[model samples]
Target: MAKEKIVLAYSGGLDTSVILKWLKETYDAEIIAFTADIGQKDELDGLEAKALSTGASKVYIDDLREEFARDFIYPMFQSGALYEGQYLLGTSIARPLIAKRMVEIARAEGATAIAHGATGKGNDQVRFELTAAALAPELGVIAPWRMDEFREQFPGRAEMIAYAEKHNIPVQASAAKPYSTDRNLLHISFESGMLEDPWFDPSATSNEEMYVLSVSPEEAPDQAEYVELEFEQGNCVGVNGEAMIPLEIMEKLNELGGKHGVGRVDMVENRFVGMKSRGVYETPGGTILFAAHRKMESLTMDREVMNLRDSLNARYSSLVYNGFWFAPERLALQALVTESQKNVSGTVRVKLYKGNVIGAGVKSHVSLYNPDIATMEADPTKAYNQNDATGFIRLNALRLKVASGVEQNAKK
Candidate 1:
């Protein structure tokens, strides 16, 4: 009889490392660890060696950064899917890509099961499992955190640390500095530990070391810098008049925005799993793109089209946040959003100063902003019809006047 094989999404982090070793010991299976490289800035360095040392049979580190930025990040950015009005969906967007790659590796390795370290309480477990279900339903999902044996064996971080120590696994677990963080190209998210307290005021110096993206706004640069972004069909293609790929564009904006101390958010949001959690995020490129894209839409998109898209933005955001990336509702809504952006070609000039993203200007070839029609200085006979407005206003306000008259009659 042969042992079953399972592919685990390995991050070389404490939790995933411990999970890797535990899966091998508990399942008596050949555990292959897979790590996706999504612009983590050398976080993947020596991950294969680390995974091997942590008891993985064979470690696979796939550089999926280009594909991630091109296929997933770009489209989501185009749709302007900001989770819960503040979160940039950084962790949300990265999960599917990672999960997809994990499934691919599983198939390649001929694994019967896939594994993840996402806690049972977080939205990431749903995101990872849903993606795996959509991509490779036949593969059994081995979630150790959800398993009674694993949960009882390692009740907390301390137990996990003890297990790692027994296995001679290298880990960063300690009594102090217990906050958890996830980082990728799109954004960095901080949660758990110290963030559990709603009244903790994340801005306080006690948590200053937790912020990876930037310092406080008070420490930001006093000078403002202007940058121009070029959009084609709602996707940002160029920055400051230089054409660049999706990933390059993001990198450029992130550098510029980070230099100026942009895109830091702190909020307590309702989780899909019936709990409120405090999350701090840094989305420099996303912040710039959102402001610039909205500004471009103002100049290029039709009034009714923009209004319709704006109405659905919240729904779309919710779907993405709640782990419905491959769901039909999100696909249908994305189709509508895509159709509306057909003429969203423009350039937006934005000023980034400290923590502010101010729109300086926007222009497009399909611009509906007619100075001739809108200018008060223009001749009324040319494009204006003052006479038509009298009947238009009267007809629109007739219901209000009738309601007022009825109130007066009732009073009399």
Candidate 2:
């Protein structure tokens, strides 16, 4: 009988390199490695060659930066999806896209199962598996980390390193390295290892070098720089008056935001698996865009509509963080959120100074903020009459008055 064919979401990282070799040796199966280039920069350089020499049948490397930025990042931003009011959902958002592409590769390669290097404890496993369950339920998921046989053979990094050396698989991880990083167009996240210590500051001393996307705040230029962000229907379309595609926009924002040391977050976040994990992230471009987008909405969005969306944004963010990018409820939220952005088109000026994105100004053709009716000085335009406020206040205060009277009667 022919050996079973499996497609592995390979990153050419320490864990994946060992998993690739083990899959071939243990299962006696043909393994195809797929690496998605979603803005890891130098990390993608030798992935294809490395996978082949380690015993994979073939390797697939594709540039998904544009798709990632346009489809995943932009739509999520429309709802202003920020997990727990802080996280930009960078790693959380990228997993489903990677898994979706992996499923596609598996189908095209005529593979029986899909596999990933995500450990059982981490959220990535659920992300990868849930995407598979949602997209291709027929394709079996093989998680070697959860398998007792594989775990016993390679209990930790030392055993994996020994196995890689024994099998001649190339990996750059050392036993002493203290953290793992995941990078994409939107952001780069560092977690595990020494980062497990919630009290540890990754920005201190040599750890500062761990930041790849942005500089430390202390090192940023003293002079604040201003940039204008232009949006069309809630999606950031350009920067500094230049129209750009999704990739160009992100690249430009990343460059500017990094130079200003904007968007470094260190926090212990609650993971879906019922534990808190400390992570340090650099999301320069995403932070800039998110700030500018909200400023633009302030000019064009309706008050009640904005409030209602804000109430649901937390739920929307949770859905994205929990790997429900393809779920029905998230889709429904996206639809409602996108509708709210119909008039959210404008330019927002932001000052980037020492890791802060300060709102400078905002203007829109359809802005609800009318100076004629809002100015306290005079009624030159007669747009709003002050006399109308008497009835408005009385009507609104009627319930309060009645409640006060009822309280007094009860006391008596």
Candidate 3:
């Protein structure tokens, strides 16, 4: 009988590389390695050769940058989803896209199972498995870190390194660099290892190496830089008046934002698995977009509509963080978000300097901001009457006056 086949989400990293070899030896399974190119920059270099040398039967690398930004990143950004008001949900958002591709590959290759290198303790495992279950429940999901047998065989990074050495797997991972990192077009995140200590200050010289997509705020140029962003129906369409594709827009913003030391966040965030993790992230492009998008909305969106959307921002963000991208609630919420963006078309100028994204100016053809009524200087012909404030304030103060009288009676 032919050996059972399994599709492994391979990143050519230390953990995944070791998993590839271990799966082959332990299960006697044919390993089909799949790597999704979601803008990992130089990380993809020599990935195919390394996977095949490490014991993969057939390796596949697909470029999903455009798809990732257009479908996953853009929609999440449109909803203004931020996990705990800090993280942009970078790694969290990428997992579903990766899982979706892994499922497709498994079906195509006639594989019976799909495997990932996410540890049992982290949120990625949940994200990957939930996506798999939602998309292809019939396929077996294999998580080595969660299994007792796999954990006993390789207790930690040291044991995994030893196994890799024995199996002749070529990997650059070492015990010296304890922290692990995940990177993509959206952001780069660092956690575990040295970052575990919540009191540890990463601003020290030792932690300088953790940053990849941005520079230190002190190192940024003294002068501020300004950039204009164009949006159509809540999607960024151009930068500095230059029209570009989704991928190109991200690349441009990342370069500009990185140079100005924008988008650096450090916080202890609550993971879906009932634990809090300290993580440092660099999300240059995302930060720029977030600020610019809000500025555009201020100009174009109505006050109450924006407030209603803001009320649901936390719930929307929670759904994304908890790996509910395919869930029904998220889809329904997205519909409302999309509807709210129908008139959110305009250009916003943002000033970037020393880790700050400040709004400079914003304008829209359908802007609701009326200078005639809002200006401090009284306008004789303006529709807004200053006399109307008397009745409005009196009516609003009625409830407070009644409550004060009731309190006095109780004291008496």
Residue-level lDDT of model 2, residues 293-331, one tens digit each, is 999999999999999999998899989888888888988
Candidate 2 minimal-lDDT segment of 10 residues: 169-178
| Candidate 3 lDDT by residue in tens digits, 1-412 | 9889999999998899999998998899999999999999899999999999988999999999999999999999888888898999999999999999999999999999999999988999988888898899999999999999999988877888888888888778876778899999999999888789898888676778768999889999999999999999999999999999889999999999999889999999999999998999999999999989988988898888899999999999988888888888999999999999999999999999999999999999989888877888987557888899999999999999999999999999
RMSD of each: 1.8, 1.3, 1.3
Question: Which segments of candidate 1 are over 4 A away from where they belong?
Answer: 402-412
Q: Which ten residues in a row have the lowest lDDT in candidate 3?
A: 202-211
The reply for model 2, stretches above 4 Å from the true place, is: none
lDDT (tens digit, per residue) of candidate 1 on 118-164 = 99999999999888888899999988889899899988888888888
Task: Give the alpha-carbon lDDT of every model.
Answer: 0.86, 0.92, 0.92
Return the clash pairs for model 2, or none: none
Clashes of each: 0, 0, 0
lDDT ranking of the models: 2, 3, 1
Better of 1 and 3 by TM-score: 3
